[model samples]
Target chain A: MNAKTSSPIPPAEWIVAGMGLLVFTAVLGLMVWDAVAGDQSPPRITVEVDSITRSGDGHLLKFRARNDGGETAAEVVVEGELPASGGETETASATLDFLPAHSERKGGFFFKAQPERETVRLRASSFREP
Target chain B: MVRRGPKTLMSRRASATHKPAPRGTSRHFLRALARAFAGAIVFGLPLLMTMEMWWLGFHADRGRMALLFILSLPLLVGLSHYSGFEPTFGWVDDVVDTFVACAVGFVSSGVILLLFGLIEPGMAASEVIGKIGLQTLPASIGALLATGQFASPEEREADQKRFRKYQGELFLMMVGAIFLALSMAPTDEMMLIAYMMTPTHVLGLIFLSLVVMHAFVHAVESSGKAYVPSGTPFWSVFLRITIPGYVIALLISALILWAFERTDSCGPATLMGSVIVLGFPAAIGAGASRLII
Candidate 1:
């Protein structure tokens, strides 16, 4: 078996092996990077009730922020605000019973946003899929 | 283009028999049926899934083919058990599977729903990631832990190369599954509609399929040389890569579904009747992949 058949395998074979090995490393590196950089597991939703308010015209609202989710939703606890849109904010308790457990609930609060007072845009994080 | 098996395939005459027989009893018939069925499922499902997405996208405001296919994929696992071809490997197949699965999975995993939830309002990226993390971390950790120690490292590393390929395939399947879900979701921002669907019953079925199929695919093939084929082009790549992805996606979907169930949702179906009907094919056929073992 001289140079014709296979005296010895060509150095290119080693090159091919090296290339394959390189590709594996690169992919593994990428997977590891993704696992670290991304690695976001999932998401849980929890809601909090911040403030209960009563407006001047007569409406109620409960302020809330979510602990681990997107929206900081407000529920109507007292429901006296103007049907069109006018109200006040007040602090209160007993709003807990108003919300159904194991569910996201909305309620009217005693608080109202004065159309005049700079508009308080409620901000929150985006909702990521679970 | 190329379509489902037996019906339009070269061996239509034999496939017409539709009888299940041992290898030699009717070798050509079974092979034909397998090829035809394989052709239908491999080419057909994707096409159908793609069409559904297209329909949704065109007909509705927000339609995604990949997401729809990914999400609806569980339905196929049950169906596929009845079909005759399985996914195996060639480089091209692996690549396609990965891309398709990733695109679809990301969309279905509530990504669309999150967008809708915020479209009414708006949410920041950090808030989104953070919120998602909070919801997912505990669950992910619990799952990773509960799955417990692999009874064998010899098992995982048994065929590292094959295992990696298998993992990659499974990942693609997950993406495909989610795409299926997203595609089905009507584009309009109806939180009520999407959420109503998310109640875990429908989602649970998808997850369960993923788990059973994934466990089978991985456990069996993970331990041996994956069925890598000779030189290939289109079909080889298409089939090789996507099949494993399909299996893995099945499992990932299940985990996602299970998580949804755990947190808060509708009542779990307490009946063996419904669960059994749904679960049998996926469990048994996926288990058959142990043939690879």
Candidate 2:
């Protein structure tokens, strides 16, 4: 009969090694999947007017722009327009940088005119590729 | 009469004392896994609870995140060399231990995040992966440190090789500095403190780093548990141990800051500010490693 029946390295170590290999391969695969699946489409920016609330100085017109596409948008310009009772247009704008795909940025445009009495419009003006 | 060779005798002795039975092997693995998980919790729980880390995971650059993963390979190898969770004799064994620790880290991070309700089915895949990946680093280090800190003396002695040389001591300090600096690297407060500090404050921090490192070594020496015996005068020990340790801590601090992209787009002064700010913790970690390891 043989004096011993096993290898120098223990079976437990082999099991641990197998687990490690599984994790490494899985993480690598996920990274590859992310690289391939990301940035396939151009960024589509949409502006949504969330709320108009009264601030101490004026009415705060809070709006957010959502990027629905698969790429990042930089220097995103969003424009807000308040129609006046006197038939004139008042405008405010804000710029956001490096807004990633499937993400949103929120900002507020203060207006002296009461937004509840008039129409408040918010739109995506322009966005550049980051 | 049967003939018994030296190989047979050696194998018999090994099996009798060192080797476990087949059924015991599986049990050993389960216990090791449990220990690793516990280590992950003990060391990584605070970072897991941090909201800033969560935010950083989501907002951090994906490219840098990938780079950090790539850079981590060597650190794992080194950790496995010095303080692996299992008895490893060869390169392959060390590599295996490194991977096992990583797997433990990954699973622990995922489980904790899931329990916290931070991970949801509707979340973006990138976000989910990034958060888990970022947390895996600290958790993996914790797993590596667990065996060193908790293993039975017999089990530890099976693998413990005394790192008594100057190079080994320096390497240990580097590893400890990196580990400790990492705990604070992901926070927003690093940059905030850097921004808030004046030039005078930066000088004070540098002085503090040196003084603290020296005092730690001095205290250890006075306590008579000095790991590396100083055979020379005060100047020699100061130059060899304290000054070099502080320098390594500063370098590690700078490297860690750069890895976290904390120094990105900053001027030299600001970069130095961040490095010195983080160096405070790194230096303490460096000094304390001597006593622990």
Q: Give the best candidate by TM-score.
A: 2
Chain A vs. true chain A, TM-score per model, equals 0.26, 0.74
Model 2 CA deviation exceeding 4 Å by range: A1-12, A28-66, A69-100, A103-130, B1-24, B155-161, B221-227, B291-293
Clashes of each: 70, 0
Chain B TM-score of every predicted model? 0.25, 0.85
lDDT (C-alpha) at residue A45 in model 1: 36
Candidate 1 lDDT at B14 equals: 41
Give TM-scores for every candidate, taking all chains together and pairing residue i with residue i: 0.27, 0.73
lDDT of 2: 0.75
- Put down candidate 1 lDDT per residue, A91-126, tens digits, no spaces: 333232211111243333343433211333232233
Fnat (0 to 1) per candidate? 0.00, 0.30
Q: What is the interface RMSD of each candidate, in Å?
A: 17.2, 4.6
* lDDT of candidate model 1 versus the reference: 0.32
lDDT by residue (tens digit), candidate 1, B41-70 = 232233233322222211111112223233
Cα lDDT tens digits for candidate 2, A1-130? 1322222455776776688778766665665566656565787888878788999988998887887877667788989888878899888999986556677677889898887524788888888864
